[model samples]
Target chain A: MKVDIVVDARYKSCPGPLLALAEAVMKASPGQIIMLLATDPGAPRDIREWALNVGHKVLNIEKADETYQIYLEVSS
Target chain B: MSKISIIVASEKLDKLLPAATLATTAAVMGWESEMFFTFWGLLALKRDYEPKEVSSDYKVYEDYLRRAVSSGAMPSWLEILEQGKKTGRLKVYACSATMSFLGVKTEDLVEYVDGVVGAASFLSKAKDSDINLFIS
Candidate 1:
């Protein structure tokens, strides 16, 4: 789907994308999808884990080469 | 919610790295994370907290660690902590007594430090935490 907000965390450090995601996700309302494009190999797992821990839901994640494309929905 | 409190009492880069790693992870996991820098650790919170490989009990690993860090194999402990603070619920605290003894002021500390606290306050927070770690 077309997400209005895209956070490009490509080449960012570990946990950096998580923080970016946290910050970006807050800008959108519940039900809005936020896309995170990250190059950090560990960011997918970090995002998944953090999403679960915070009660947010990750709709899907796609891996293209070494980069991670994650789609997350903000939970109210 | 669970909480994790780390007492950083050393100046070693290795110790501080793991402490920051764990603190950030805890916070990202929806757990409150607190870091108390005391004694030797407080030295690292200074405004000029440069990353260096300091020799600890692990003397044999010093050269290897230093080389690896210089070669980009590792980020400085301060770098790790900065990343943690950017995205996590991590709070960094400097020890009041240590600051007094060292004549360090809040302005002398890194800008990220959440606050300066004493042992009693640190203890109170630690007591309520789910995990407490003493890294020295």
Candidate 2:
């Protein structure tokens, strides 16, 4: 099953929420898809680097107005 | 898959903020994160003693509290936990042994705590975690 979470990170700049989302997705066993919704302008670049470092797949990223949607697939 | 478990052991307000910040960061990275507060750290979960304007760096305890309140940060320990909870990725657990030693009940803890758990329980849950952090 796919786990989808929407994070409203507009008020905070720290990478905490994005890190948490990635961890949650990884714990969902292998081959699970995690969809993260974030409004933070820095999320895309930060999350991209984080995913690469952790060996997760950054499937796609889509921008919708002021928010961004990131889809990540757990590869390990 | 990444999972992290954090153990908080200090009651000092300043120390707790850094730990909470790290926990929030772990959660944001898509990790299943759990924080176990024990010993002095339990004091930080109390409902009273909100720090309003705390200085990020303090040479003394009083200065820390004064700056915390002046900065309009957290004036009470409970408020700090509330701010962490609002991030929505953290699970806060109070140590059961500490509560018993202090003769405190679970209801006496701040509302943000998930439950009162023991060290064994916490360790078991953390066995599979990719990262384990201890904040003292």
Candidate 3:
């Protein structure tokens, strides 16, 4: 719930949102929380899959006004 | 780590977009990703060359694709490839035969190209890949 970084990738399509999050994750300390805001329809699933592959934790996903708010926790 | 090997055979924007997307995605996912640009695909590696056109049948939607990139909805194919490269997990190879056929020298290629390789060399490197894709 304590978000340390916010990555705004709304209106960016596939790879954009994920790439932004990946970049943030690289700079994040272990246990830091990053919230990604993305408008692309595929962002949620893409983020989930990417987190799984990269060993991050997806805290939660919420949808509002056609945008997705994805919460992630950085891993060591 | 899993590995994905892609053989790119076209210079068209549409073909290159998907190929780049897949290769980059695989790299970011901690997989070993390699792309061999052969035939027309090799043109995309040429210095200062940008593939603006789609395949003939998709000409009508070329503008649509361009707009998406311009409007910031989609990243350019090269941008995607560059992101993957930043992770140090992706390898890009230009086809040696195509270079000779197209009269492209090593200096003609963009700096990101890892090397120029022949079919046998690429195949031997790609043989253990978990996934293989031919994108044209």
Considering every candidate listed, which one attains the maximal DockQ? 3
lDDT of 2 by residue, B8-125 (tens): 9887666666677667655555557789989977876776644333333554566745554455433333433444466576799999999888777877777878888898999998
Better of 1 and 2 by DockQ: 1
Q: Rate the local accuracy (lDDT) of all candidates.
A: 0.82, 0.68, 0.94
Candidate 2 Cα misplacement greater than 4 A, ranges:
A1-76, B51-69, B72-84
Tens-place lDDT per residue, model 3, B15-108, is 9999999999999999999999999999999999887899999899999999998898999999999999999999999999999988999999
Instruction: Give candidate 3 regions above 4 Å deviation.
Output: none
> What are the chain A TM-scores of the candidates, in order?
0.93, 0.77, 0.97
Which residue runs does candidate 1 get wrong by more than 4 Å?
A: B52-89, B111-114
User: Per-residue error at B35 for model 1, in Å?
Assistant: 0.9
List native contact recovery per candidate, as a fraction of 1: 0.20, 0.20, 0.76
For model 3, give the interface RMSD. 0.8
> Can you write out model 1's per-residue Cα lDDT over A1-76, one digit (the tens) per residue?
8786899878666656776787787678988889999888888888888898888988889999988899998899
lDDT of 3 by residue, A5-74 (tens): 9999999988899988998998999999999999999989998998999999999999999889999999
Residue-wise lDDT of candidate 2 within A1-76, one digit each (tens)? 3555444444334343464465476467677777777766777888887777567888888888876777888776
Instruction: Identify the candidate with maximal TM-score.
Output: 3
Ranking by TM-score: 3, 1, 2
Mind giving the per-residue lDDT tens digits that candidate 1 earns over B1-136? Answer: 9899999988787777678878877776778899999999999898877756654577778787677556644555665676568665789999999999999989999989999999999898789898899998
Please estimate how well model 1 matches the true structure, expressed as its whole-model Cα lDDT. 0.82
List DockQ for all candidates: 0.23, 0.14, 0.84
Worst 10 residues of 1 chain B by lDDT: B68-77
